[model samples]
Target: MTTAARYATFGVREAHGVSPAYERLALAVAQDDEVLALLEALPPAKRQPNLLFSVVRLLGGPVEEPAAFHDYVVANWPAIEPEMRTRWTQTNEPGRCAVLLPVLAALPQPLALLEVGASAGLCLYPDRYAYRYGEHLLGAGEPVLDCVATGVPLPDRRPEVVWRAGLDLNPLDVTDPADVAWLDALIWPEHTHRRARLRAAAAMVAADPPLLVRGDVVDDLPALAAQAPADATLVVFHSSVLYLVPEPRRDAFAELVRGLPGHWVANETPEVLGCDGLPEPPSEAQHNVLALDGKPLAWTRGHGQALSWFG
Candidate 1:
């Protein structure tokens, strides 16, 4: 798809209900040839709406109004282009832990988690946060996550995570203000709750940082997996991480993980994993396919707002 098509689809499928500001901005960007051309100059992967909008937000540019946003993006193209080139759209949403909780809790007694594309390793601390799975609350803490789930056995308790680590091309440090600021910017304009959740999650990780390694997911996975305790179930997992990777690389990573001991949990867009025969998603809104050991189990909202299990 062209950049314009991607932006239009994102506006409709992703931001329509979640973020009005983003929906308007994305639709406007899709129609603006000037802006589209500017985006076309960047690498294909860097042309993502999330990257552009986040960079603008990060640089204090306007995203609420289309005209102003366009002008600012063009005016600041020199600065924006460089940032987009260097940065990846690592939206480390801690809310996604809600979707993973059910599967993680069902795994063996203790788990050793290794996350791919773990920007700040916030998802690594699922045991640290609280969750509200539609009236069935689990744990007690700040930044409580809420998700509407159906046809799923809600976890009775959080998993006992004995070890946790993350692999990213550029692992973000939760303690760094700049890194945290980038994370904050990646969140949609209207998601104040998510911003608050980010702070809480960041602080939690900062208090005791995980072993976040700066390396390629495929090349560096085995070394990191080797570090996991043998006694624990080493569950290698990733959420919204594979789409950025080329198809071949994604397949290679999948193969490598399957060969390793323990389980594998992947929550990604159906197309990302070439998933076939998935039941119809619960709604028209964008939903990722949640699979365990390459078996599709549920359809999940991007930010873990809801889930529909059809295992």
Candidate 2:
């Protein structure tokens, strides 16, 4: 309820201060009464109101120069009055800047991004847009999410981004406008800014689509890896998903990821999540980087934060 775990739930600080939209919402943690109520009414089971898990339909956003997010919330009263309905909203929408940077850094240029838990593909389309990290700008409209940790420097030279694709145990295909809208529904109506960002991101997907496959991570990741395009840095990644797999299943999934050809990235911890099988993190924090062979690469402050690269 009270800003759970620094930057644990939202990617507000992850993208840095450039996202005027997210910044506004993050700062709104104080001013907005609705958000405060939602937080106060935090679900006892989860401790935090994850706006990403709802199965309901979210109404679309204003086309251009939309009103402030405050306006949108008032209009969607019936769907969101009780507010905690969409518990996993932010969980599925990728905006965590800290965890994404290092994953990108460890890859070879022109790499093929194969995301394992790509919920609504919010981050799958990161490269297609321009970002604002304070004053810096990166990637004009691609699916790569460039994160700027407070103490870390972002890579100026980008890898040759050959292809961006993802596989999810339950993938949300944006090509299906309704699916995209449903994903939007997961956003907390109180946070108008987030809705705006989701809308803009969805529009991009409407243009150029990312390849998404539906399958279980434990059962499907190995096949996904085998079928990945050759010679590309095979970076397999996931966030907040490890906790859901039962421990035995989690171990199996980890083994599958560890044995894969390229690299692996994960942002999760069983101690702090609803995910079933996860163990305590490699460390206390559910954030860090690993080599393709399962060696610890760097200890990041959080995902997308800086890394203490072993190399």
Candidate 3:
């Protein structure tokens, strides 16, 4: 069957209680001649698949990023096999970890950051001016924040970040308006506010594009992690990017980071299990904020984006 068809079937079956308002995917694979042709193109391993497709099926609503990939499947089903296309669930929600805000407060001065899998880099440049923290406001019209967080002490004039960069398998170069527009369009329309924030950030980056690289995390992790300044609290962070990696590969990458010297904070899913037959799906998007010694400080998500305060 076509990849979309397979995923559609899986999603339809899972909708019972997984997501109340999930997308309703179709299972017209048998009827579509294109599906058979697509299935024929699959390697023996994928064609003999049991539940990989079933795990990521679509239901109830439109598949996220339909604009970037839907038509590609419809027009080229024979060329696109089930294994190549995956159903992705976009996660752009801010965190609710209590330790995070307090960590931000402890910065000694302005700072730098590096975000891996920074799809469009909006959250990477989180300090572009004003933000509301319940009744308190931070950054007061600053052109993005240069925050250098610590375990204690919320002070102004933190460390000066010599740089801020990001790495992604598919990096978004906002200097090109077309690319920026495409990234903006990729965002689901339901998230109007997020779309707006992404647009504003895109505009800011368009003027001064952030340093980005398109590469594999396995190969790029070491170099990127090593780039952190010694005096600076080097933070190698990512959001919702770990699910795409294999367990062994993910473990290897995390081990490499832990071995590095600096603050290694990775915001990944906490889900260490639940892939069923598929081996890549993570357990949960745990908000991992670690100290320079490679220690996890908290875990959470919400208004403050705090998960837990181990401190």
Candidate that would win on TM-score: 1
What are the C-alpha RMSDs, in order, of all predicted structures? Answer: 0.7, 8.1, 8.4
Instruction: List candidate 2 segments past 4 Å from native.
Output: 1-90, 141-148, 270-311
lDDT tens readout by residue for model 3, 1-311: 45655545544543323332223323333233554465556543354212222222222123433332344456544433442443222232332222244554455435456776765565555444454434344655423222223233333422344567777777766676645555544343344665565555666666666677777777886787667666666666665567667689777877777776555665443453222222221123223433333444544331223334444
TM-score of each candidate? 0.99, 0.61, 0.60
lDDT of each: 0.94, 0.53, 0.47
Q: For each of the candidates, give the backbone clash count.
A: 0, 36, 44
- For model 3, the local distance difference test gives 0.47
- TM-score leaderboard ranking: 1, 2, 3
Error at 282, model 2, angstroms: 18
Error of 2 at 177 (Å): 3.6
After TM-score superposition, the amount by which residue 129's alpha carbon in candidate 3 deviates from its true location, in angstroms, is 3.9
lDDT of 2 by residue, 27-69 (tens): 5444556645554554543333234123223444321211454
